[model samples]
Target: MTLAWLCLMWVFLSATVATLPLRIQFIPGAILLVAGPVLIIVIGLQVGFVFSVIALAAYVSMFRNPLLFLLARLRGRKIEVPR
Candidate 1:
């Protein structure tokens, strides 16, 4: 299913980002953090809660990077990672 592919890709991207050296790792993490919510919003609109949850988890993991966290905090929003 499309949702399954999305989840798989999310895992792959996360893993690939994590394996990269520090200088490059941030790029993929930033991509995941920014792009994930958009993907979630798109899929969540048509699919269901399951895909949204997966996307949210990936987004959180991406944003968990300290640099990303500080950016999010600067904007003054709660760093939500589901329940």
Candidate 2:
């Protein structure tokens, strides 16, 4: 029950972030990016690795752009923000 609620909340928050303008989405998006892995860990412990992996896939798909940007920054590549 709790895991289901958390998943739903994650989906809702992700959807809300998607609706906002890119600049405005940054803070909440970053919060979700940080929280996502912790939730995946808890989900794995509560349920199983398979379910956790599925959740992680969903998370990665939803945040692909931000994740890619972070990766680029980590690699010392320049990221250009479109106007």
Candidate 3:
């Protein structure tokens, strides 16, 4: 029950962030990006690996662009952000 609520809240927050300007979305989006994996781990512990994997795939799809940008930075590649 608690996990379900948290997942719902996460989805709601993500949708809200999507509506904001790109620059403004970064802070909250970044927080969510960090929180997501932790939440997945907890969910795995509570539920099971299969559900956690599904959640991870969904999360990756949802945050693909931000994840890609972070990956580029980690790899020492320059990524241009659109203004």
Candidate 4:
């Protein structure tokens, strides 16, 4: 289905962004980060909860470092971003 293709494209894009330098990746990475949840929601509605959960797990693992950085900032921990 179309949704499956979209998910595949998202995975490919995420992998491509992962290979870029951290600084260079910030923009596209953030975009993907935001889009991920929306994509998962759509998947859940179209397919099923199990597939969406799997996608979410993959998303979390892929963006683990960025997610952690955001968590630290939220907790008021003075974590420095690597240059």
- Top TM-score prediction, candidate number: 3
Ranking by TM-score: 3, 4, 2, 1
Model 3, 1-83: lDDT tens per residue? 99989988998999999999988998999999998998899889999999999999999999999999999999999999987
Per-residue lDDT, model 3, residue 55, is 95
The best-first sequence of candidates by lDDT reads: 3, 4, 2, 1
Estimated TM-score per prediction? 0.60, 0.93, 0.95, 0.93
lDDT of candidate 2 vs native?
0.91
Query: Candidate 3: global Cα-lDDT?
Result: 0.94
Q: Give the alpha-carbon lDDT of every model.
A: 0.73, 0.91, 0.94, 0.92
- Looking at candidate 2, the ten consecutive residues that score lowest on lDDT are 2-11
TM-score of 4: 0.93
Error of 1 at 72 (Å): 6.4
Clashes of 1: 0
Residue pairs with clashing backbones, model 3: none
For each candidate, C-alpha RMSD in Å? 6.9, 1.0, 0.7, 0.9
Residue range 1-83, candidate 1, lDDT tens digits: 78668767976887888788777766677777666677788778878889778767757765666656678889997895432
Candidate 2, residues 1-83, lDDT tens digits: the string is 98889878988998999899988988998999999999999999999999999989988998899899999999999999764
